[model samples]
Target: MRGNTLSYGTRYLGRIQGIALLVGGAMLVGGCARLRPTADGELLGDDAVVAHARLLQMADTRAMDTLLVRQALAASTPSVRAAAALAIGQVSGRTLNHLARSLLADGDSAVAANAAYSLGLLRDTASVPALTGALGGRQSVAVEAAWALGQIGAPSRAAIEDALSKAALPEPVLASLLLATAKLRPVPVAQLIPFLRHSNAEIRWSAAYPVSRTLAPAGVRAMLDAARDESAPVRALAARALGRSATGDSLAAEALGALDTLARDSSAHVRINAVRSLASYGSAATTAVVALTADRDANVRIATAQILGTVLPPQRSVWISAWNADTAFMYRRSLLVSAVRAGAMLPALSPASADGWASHADWRYRAAAAEAGGSARSSSALLENALPHVGDADGRVRLAAYTAFATYADSSRFAWRNQILVPALNDPDFYVRATVLQALGSRASAAETPGILASYQRALADSLNDARIAAVRYLAAAWKRDSTNFPDSVRAMVQALKPSDDPLVRAEALESSIFSSWIAAPPGRRRLDWYQRKVRSVLLPALAGRPLSATIQTERGAMTVELFSIDAPLTVDNFASLARAGYYRNVQFHRVVPNFVAQDGDPRGDGNGGPGYAIRDELNRRRYGRGAVGMALSGPDTGGSQYFITHSPQPHLDGGYTVFGRILDGFEVLDALVQGDRILQVRIR
Candidate 1:
């Protein structure tokens, strides 16, 4: 991940010679006084300086050019000679091939090591001696030698065999070799088996994933044995390996038993891994996972609950009735998590079980239930168990409760959920407050977004960009929910009225407003269906009638956007009319979900605010989300002037409502409008 090459100017000037020995070789250590700059005497320097500069210029293509080889081999400085050798190997020809072989004798390890890399890159068979020598010289020397040898293919077979034969190869080196070999050959499993008990944790851990992909009967048993090891990391890795392994009659009991022990492992991480792995076992390990859904650790319980949420049949009860029979205090929290994941309302646990979790003082369990049980529909019974517990002393639990509400807020079926969000706005945790804004962003109507909007407006200036970015996502979601163009127009009006400090914010404003709108109102399943959607156009005094300048920037150039008033007559007329009025000006492009498009256009400089009014559903065929420029809406066809661009396919918004036009070029620039990046301004060309 680190930069792979040194900058050329520094690399060239940094290598000055310091002293000359009687043997004609120069010792270049900078501290040597004998070679220090002199005031009076001229050393043999002019010719050498000219030659060095010439060599520096020649270095780029010297490997392919044969004329430089003899001079490069005879160069006074090892560095220059090394540079030339490196280039020599880069080219394909007979004469330069000999020069690459000659570089093995170079004294400088840096030069020789590079030459080894070049040899490997060249895959020249004769460089075997050089690579083998590099293996013993230094670890980097050896490691690169090994990598290159492997890259060299079978040319260095004897050296590779000899290196493998040595029992003393250090674990890191072996690990590197194993990692490298795993890339090259299927024998990585066989080669790594002997090193399983090796003293390196990294080697064992890295080996686990690859081994899981290539399981042998013996390897499976070894991994199973490792699952019971005292080391939690080892146990976790072994569990993952086993989960991916194919189970036959011989391994079935062992596999299930390992999962059982792992689900109950004292380590939280191991338990979480077990929850995921157990799910991979499907129904074979369902009973164990069910028991695990009751694990004492909140993480394990949550993971079990969440995994079962998806893996369990949709609408089929994920919760079983038998979990209520568990009388143990610890068992209740975990069991209820399982029950809730099964889509059942809160299970009828014994009152004693709830009191024990509430009384034990850990407090997170109570919070965990509120957070994890978010999937479980709230009822009078659930509220009886959950509402009083929200008053728990632990601040963490209270925070979880607030965050969980956001997950629940969007469900119309859970209309009573806002009872949770309104109160949580003031919670101490910024995390909880953030989550509330997000939920409200999705579920909040324009009226409902007022409080969250003010909060986001204040927080956007805070140093943390994540809060701002999140606020943008929610605000975008909120605006889309309120389908009227006016909610979005209010945003454009503010931007049009704003002071231009970051012209960048203007780009974001345009992007966010446009993106959220597209997400809100995608094209109808049939293009004609989108035409049926309607919104009342408020005629702006400035816009008697003019074309909208709908160009989005990409790296190559900008693409023009045209709203179709004839096709989606109402949406087109309204947005084009707004564009003609100079409604969009210095707005911030507030939301840019990476690999997704940039969003802008909340008047508050937050993403939540949208024009007031909801429209009917206009389902269309155009896909929404990435690079899409479509109308924003409330519910179905409640489209407004606010529109958006998408960077990827958002099937979720398809067949929702009107899509007018897409960016024809400039997608690269659209990709560049990153979070915290400003929109310069969106104007007619």
Candidate 2:
């Protein structure tokens, strides 16, 4: 019945393309060899390709028409069946699990692989037996089944271990099985130790990844062995696992020694992870970490500065020297904050010295000064000095000032805290307003404060979706704090939002936990019309055989990424369109975590800006290996213009984010990127 209700867009395109191709084929076949149709009566050439594309569009839009997907699953063409199987997973078509499960035994490896991947996405526990059985069938199929079993969580751990125990498995399949084992709770760490020494470096890193997450004391010795691994990636993960398992015992001393050696390793990646791991040893690691303050790599220096701040005593002169020596904004900011945290009396926090940084030409320094003010022992003076920055010309500085005041300032002792804060709710920047709402909501006293409650109430009607979501969060916090004293007007306002036109707002309301009845009700299905229109107008045109590589020109250097147009057509189209429109020009990489990811694409220069809308995730089988480009999200289906590039293999991010592309070159540029690095332009080929 659902298939019978196919949108006009699907039918119109099929008729036009199919007829034109049929006419063309007749002319060609008359002059050459006759073409044939497939066993299912579907044409075997261009027509089938068009049909496959149509199924992908349905998947992209998250169309709720399951009957069409079902029909495609049974199509004679392997490509069409593969597309349909993937679509069922993308759309979360739980009802179509049976059809997808049947495809696990499909003759085509691609079809069976996609079917296993779909079952994983659906988390179909019922299909675990079928998925496990497919583990010995084909290389591609077995890997997907292992990953799917892992995605299914605890139910599949035993099967995963059983498969891992088998001898002579393909390296790729063994790697997938090892990574999948990480997803299970109370990981079988002992079983993974031998793989830490696997001849293939890829398998070794894969084993080390799970060990890093759930490192028990038993794995510490093996990890120490891995810490000396020839591969930097394996060593880096081993360093992390050692840190996690570190205790005040003999093994911890051995780990500390290995970490110390790794701290000076030639690789910056190894040094960064090793330095962070050393921090767990407290005073024992301070000396080794302190020596790396002059490390050649900025990221290493930043890591070293951070550890020293946490481990060093108050009177250590290295804090002041490091803060003064580094001219880099992020490094200097790290040292300054760390100095304050260690209870060191830095001249920078002094009233006269604070003015120098607060009035610095660079807004980054000014923001840093505001952040340092928050970390100081006596926050009142620093808070007072930062009060004027609440109205700074730059939104970042203003955001910092307000965040510091809300988080660090003693509201009871400081009379002007709320006076400066209450006015910011009306700030021009939506991010600032959203931040203020979250700050207000987190306070225990917000429920009794008429002004704060009124602020949440007023924000419910704010123009921005983010602000409204924050207001809903505030209401949820208030209700949880004490519902009997909750305001009825706020309750009514939340109720009104339950049926909001904005999907994000409605989703937020459902997430707020205030409406139990609304939570129990199944979500309504979205129509395929909008998605079909987007497919016809935007997605299809973008995929017209042009190269999909995008070169991101930054001050550091240009990083070329090959977009995964076939797998993530809509997301690629959205990014390419934005790049062409100059949307990402001059955007700064607002967030960067060492050895993790460098995130950018915020026109607002904060992490929150988008292209005024959201797009559904096109999650595929792409693993988040080093240089993998992925769409960042606030929640599901919230991807927009913002994206991030991984610095190393991130198994955790594999299925979560939309991996639309990957860097083909300029890896050094990716490693060198810091928080304030700017994207000069993105040139799409």
Best by TM-score: 2
Off by over 4 Å in 1: 1-137, 140-170, 177-205, 213-236, 244-251, 257-336, 339-369, 375-398, 408-429, 440-452, 458-469, 476-489, 492-685
Error of 2 at 647 (Å): 0.7
Residues 1-685, candidate 1: write the lDDT tens digits: 0010111111110000011111011111122122211122323132333332333223311223455545655655443454455544433344555566555556766556556656665666777777777666665556556656666655555566567667876665554455444334343455556666766666675455445545577768777877877667667667666763455568867887887888888776577667777777667776787776556654455456546643454342445443443444334454556556555544343345554343445554566566554545454434544555556666556655554444553444256546776666555444455556656565545555555555656554443222333455555565667646336555653334322122122223345553333333222122211221221121111122332346543332455665442223334545554555644445445444333344554432334333322222222223353467655442333333345566543323433445665666666566545433444444443
RMSD of 1: 24.2
Writing each residue's lDDT as its tens digit, candidate 2 over 1-685 gives 0010111112100000000000000111112123334433534454444455466555644554676676666666565566677877888988889887898998888788888998998999999899989999899999999999999999998899999999878999999999998888888888998888788999998888887776477667778888889999998888777783454476877888889899988889899988888887878888888888888999888877766766788885766676666778778777878777677766655557644677887877777778776776676555555776888899878988877776774644245336766677777666677678777776534344455445545655544466666666666677778677766765555454444445555566676566544554443343334434444444333344444789999999999998887678778878988999999899898777778777887766656566656666777888889999988776567677778888888877767778999999999999999878999999988
Question: Candidate 2 at 24: error in angstroms?
Answer: 31
In candidate 2, which residue ranges exceed 4 Å CA deviation?
1-63, 244-247, 376-388, 407-423, 443-464, 479-482, 486-499, 511-547
In the predicted model 2, the residue pairs found to clash are none
lDDT of each: 0.49, 0.72
TM-score of each: 0.38, 0.85
Residue 131 CA displacement from its true place in model 1, Å:
14
Q: Count the backbone clashes (under 3 Å) in each candidate.
A: 67, 0
Tell me the RMSD of model 2 versus the true structure: 8.7
